[model samples]
Target: MLATPIYIICSPCPQVGKTLIARLVCEFLLLKNGTAASFDVSLKEPSLLDYLPHITETADVIDTYGKMQLMDPLIFHDRVAKVIDLGFHAFDEFFKMCEEIGFMKETVRRYVTPIILFVAGSDRSSWRSYEMLQRQIPPGALVIIHNEFALRGGLPEAMVGEHVIRIPALPAFLKFYVDRLSFSFTGYLRDEKDWSTELHQWIRRNYTMIRDLELRVMGRQSYKPTAPCGRPRWHER
Candidate 1:
């Protein structure tokens, strides 16, 4: 059995599809026979809360109770895979609390596989946040996710040496339907849907990628590295 993962899908920039990636992870975990849930930290209505209402809840990291509500379960509950849809506003406080409380140590101690997926963005702030997280979190616990749908160009060879995952961009036409229609991937995939369409193919490919990732992390699979897509790593001027 694949070990359950705890993913914190985060980015310093808004609208870079952090929730989009989180939703996918949650769905994939459920399909793999692992229970999945999420903590929605976005101030407004994030897509995770909007769609996966049954699997997620609104969370805040500004106080002790909220931190307990968020961190304690992740550390103690080994049965459910959890996703934290971290937003821009709560970035600093969340990591601050984590670092101070030895969050990574506790997760490691409890045998929880913690994966911090920083959604890739182009802005300088995004890169800085990426670098900051690399420093704060335990080394090798960070997995940078390149959201090609909203970013441009390829990554800098120096930013992430290895273990980067890329999400291919959704075609504009498909994006239109997704934005206009209220659909759930888990529901749609289990029900009737064309398996040959671009959207379906895209979803399947992502699921494959995630499965490959899960196996790779647990030493059950291996694959050659592909050049990641997204903005190049930012260098200070």
Candidate 2:
């Protein structure tokens, strides 16, 4: 059986569409597994919680109390897929906690897989953050996200990961319609009326990409996480 998936959608740079990806993944998982939950660690408005309030809860990991509230539930393999929309502000602290508490090993032992869907950017911060995660998390668990809207110049080879998931940019005209909190990707798909529309086609392409990503993660060989030797100086740069 495949391990329960915990999709952590994160980016070290702000306003890079991290929450948009999280909303899509949460909706995708809900459709695929019939049950899914999400956490919004963002301080920005109109985050995952705002977009998918039914299944998303506000999360904070700044302090030990907040960390416990977030990590405790995730440590359990409840069989329900999870998605975390981690804000750029908490990016470093979140992973630091994971390393300190042996989170990767514990998750592996509990039949839970934690995959980091890192949004790729050309910024030095983005590049360095990706490099640091390579040492801290299993390579197989780090998936690069090529968000066309965010990175119009295209993906940098150095920032690429073992696995890549692309999010095609939607035309500005159509993007405005989907940005509304009331809008729903899955709901739009279910409506046969919009099947021939551009928005519908765009959503279909993204859903297909997400579906393929899940299958690949499931079929990939299992990984055993080892203790991180020491923190990388990537942050010092």
Segments in model 1 whose C-alpha atoms lie over 4 Å from true places: 1-4, 156-160, 220-237
Model 1 per-residue lDDT tens digits across residues 170-217: 988876655532676666676746898778888888889888777666
lDDT tens per residue, model 2, 182-215:
9999998897585778888888888898888887
TM-score of 1: 0.84
Candidate 2 accuracy as lDDT:
0.83
Model 2 TM-score, 2 decimals: 0.90
Tell me model 1's lDDT, rounded to 2 decimals: 0.74
Give the runs in model 2 whose Cα sits over 4 Å from its true position. 160-162, 192-194, 221-237
For all candidates, the clash counts are 1, 0
How far residue 191's Cα lies from its native spot in candidate 1, in Å, is 3.8
For model 2, the run of ten residues with the poorest summed lDDT: 228-237
